[model samples]
Target: MSNTFPPVDGTWRNHYLLMRHGHSQANQEGRIISSPALGLTGFGLSPRGCTQLDTLLADWRWARPQRILHSDFLRTAETAERVAAHFDLTLTLEPRLRERHFGEFEGQSDDRYAEVWARDAKDPTHRQGGVEAVSEVAARMRAVIDELERHYHDETILLVSHGDPLQILLTALEGRELSLHREREPLAPASITSL
Candidate 1:
């Protein structure tokens, strides 16, 4: 298929479809599960999440993904599996696309994310509450995009990941400050944003 998406002015050689994984067990329980310890084995997609993906795929309107890369976390893994299987495409695990490590905030109330953003707004490199630095998340997310751009030109690739990391990536892609990540629109569960 011809690439209808416009190329970046001086970079980004591939079309990108960034998608947040479906609602997870953590989302259902209103908890923040951002660490590998909890995310790897637990907080997978909920029943509603499955339904959401089924419905989304049934009436999909966006560019079809020729390749799928996703976080290894159970939630994103499940999401990518469904998408890849539906499209008969190979699924690749990209660990750098994992959720922002919440550190001390793992398994806590989701509301605690506000505090993390507050600190992030002041200093993107701050690791208060042992949280992963916003700058670090941005760097990894950017690296994934750069690598994908270099490897896959003139194709639509889907990246399944978490909300926070996706937001930081989007902000960075827009040439904005990492500290302003929260200022970008929030990525709803299973929502897709293109670049």
Candidate 2:
């Protein structure tokens, strides 16, 4: 809720829950979609996605959350809404948790999506105008978490977002090398992981 930057390695009084958005059109068609793009509205939670959400909530074994934060992207927003409703919490949109900007790659073929990421793997800092550089995405994700820390220091925050940005954030926390950025695997829809 607070926009201020948190101290580096702030108090770990609260648990941060990271979850990937449910099944989406882009995901089904293997396209690299951005958060602001069309076709993402309500197209986020497919029938199977809804099933996954039900299963996840029914089987949730993670820590109980105090607040829910997620990207405005349809899939994430929808997913967060479902989970929040299950927990009787409000869904809050946080743009920093949005999907990576695919740049020239939005709503394209699968092969093309692969090509851009391959290039990004070779040079993580290259900004191809439309696409967000890995470094930039990672930095903003850190900013989002840090800001949460400063404001919700002792409050558990549930963050629902896309795959790439989530991977970037986890990699940053693990202190892994940047060159292995693209190698991070995707997170399952409705799956919850702690940070």
Candidate 3:
């Protein structure tokens, strides 16, 4: 593993920007909505999330994105749309960027995430409570980049996803142990990290 931004591997072809979806209805309600059955349709951005996106677009500090790829989840889709509209670009729905599925914790109190993270620190592969394993999340998230590398080049791409998936992806890209993903700085709603 390399400590480089694009990974020392020759696979990277485009600049990457990782953006977590804006604060969502689920965040406002303090619930976990990881399942596609719910996330693909409901749990879109909250009023605060809309404000966050509006502010972020107004500031627009990072490189303008030539392409925008995002999770199909409603929250992420809405977030990507704002950026796409701001930049006058189109969006590509990337299911691989979806939230880390929390299985038994779906629709549960958001506080339950702490329990899963505690277990993730012990074993990245553990599926305790039926939540997606840290390694699995990292793999799928990386696969999104891998596929992008195969098809795009010399472009600034924005990847809009959920908190845990983006965290796991960044930790993997940084060549760190997946079990330590939670140790990375938390990604605020509508915040972007260059990769």
Candidate 4:
């Protein structure tokens, strides 16, 4: 957070394009699918999701990426594949980019997210009901950027991940308290946030 990342090549010149995966079956069904097991096999892109990606790529307005990294979850993987194929870049599967684990809430209605967030608002590190701690997610997300900066410079890199993980990462990058994560604007499916 707060640009604390060590300078790379004498400056933080790299740009990271943070992309949320397009709407998935979970989005269509209004369910939460955060488990890596469930995400890997089910909850892939919905038909609308495919169209969203197609439209986005047809008129992409952001910096073209030199490298693509994405969570191994099916939805994110498919999203990254679409972009990578269009840009003629290889894809790297990064588990650290996986969605936040919702534990007992997996496959539940999306509304249940409110309950977790309510608790998160009070304690960012809470892991009740087996949920992953918010701080841990922030750390792994930060680690991805740290790793990228250490190896690359002056390049645009794309990272495809789920909504919550990306949001948490952004909040951390902004130097905001994790408890305030829910206060940020919700990320639209297939939307991009650059850093």
Candidate 5:
């Protein structure tokens, strides 16, 4: 009675479980701030976020995760903590799993950020303002996944991370480009996508 997300071509052999963080303060306020920038050591989850884990655990749909890797962000860590406790698994933090370095856009609202975001995509190597390109994030995540493929072929690994990077990685895995990311559907908070 397990659920299966058919791969791109309806093939099923390798399994990669990707999950977005649960609700967070920034998430509640609809902001793009990162935990490190704000000095929130644990990626503080909001009350709704805390309840997300409770709901997830109560549901039987969540697969018992084996190896756990998550972003160091407070939101991600908070979500991982709940999952780890429920499964008694150790959570691994990879800085590479952190959210896209928003650079100049770190604390800005959507309207304020959209202008630069448009230009940023044109040349993904834009790091002058401490910003990281979507390409670099994809490369890093791909590096991690490639290594994981070598070490855990045909095995399941859960990577709990932020929206942008996950979207980037998924695009690369499918041999697509980042522009397609915006066209991609939004991943729900605490939702899981199998690839």
Candidate 6:
């Protein structure tokens, strides 16, 4: 993976924007909600999140997205919907963009994420607490881009997802060690990063 824009070798046919979903109810509650059973339907954005999207769209400075693809999770779906509505684009659900599964930590305090990430720094493949491995998350996240590259061209595509998966994807795209993903700057809720 090359960090340079346009990929330096013409590998990417589409401009990509990775946007993390806005602050969620789960975020306000400070709980881990990575299980599909919970994430798919519940924990949608908070009032602040809606305001964030409204403010962001009112400003609308990034490259206009031609397509919007997002995780089916409620928070992400809601986030994508806001952007799609703003740009008059439709949304396509992409399950691969779902939040990194937190396994046994599901429904626990969000503070437990630090423990999992610390383990990730030591062993990217370790599945402590049955959490999805960092390397696995990176691979799946990369596959999303690879699949998009195969079918799209000259289009700015918006990918709305959760924080950890996006961070892992960005780290992988930079050709960096997966174990160091947490060392990179954290992606703020409702923020967009171009790839």
Residue 146's lDDT within candidate 5 is 66
lDDT of residue 64 for candidate 5:
68
| Candidate 4 colliding pairs | none
Which candidate should be chosen as best, given lDDT against the real structure? Answer: 3
Output the worst ten-in-a-row residue range by lDDT, candidate 4.
Answer: 1-10
Q: TM-scores for all candidates? A: 0.94, 0.88, 0.95, 0.94, 0.84, 0.95
For model 6, how does the per-residue alpha-carbon lDDT over 4-93 read when each residue is reduced to its tens digit? 344635567888888999999999999999999999999999999999999889987778999999999999999999999888898999
Enumerate clash totals for all models, in the order shown: 0, 2, 0, 0, 3, 0
- Candidate scoring better on lDDT of 3 and 4: 3
Per-residue alpha-carbon lDDT of model 1 for 1-195, expressed as tens digits? Answer: 111224335756777888999988999999999889989989899998999899889988788999899999999999999999899999999999999999898889999999999999999999988999999998898888888777777898999999999989878777788899999768888888877
Candidate 4: Cα lDDT at 118: 95
For candidate 4, report its TM-score.
0.94
RMSD of each: 2.9, 4.5, 2.6, 3.1, 3.3, 2.4
lDDT of 5 by residue, 152-171 (tens): 65666788888778877777
Q: What global local distance difference test value does model 4 have?
A: 0.89
Candidate that beats the other on TM-score, 5 or 6, i.e. the better one = 6
Query: What lDDT does candidate 3 reach at residue 193?
Result: 89
Worst 10 residues of 2 by lDDT: 1-10
Candidate 4, residues 1-195: lDDT per residue as tens digits?
A: 112223323456688888999989999999999997899878899999999999999989888999999998999999999999999999999999999999899889999999999999999999999899899999999899888888998999999998899889888887789999889888999998867
- Greater lDDT among 2 and 5 belongs to 2
Instruction: List the candidate 5 regions with Cα displacement exceeding 4 Å.
Output: 1-14, 39-43
Please say which candidate is ahead in TM-score: 1 or 6: 6
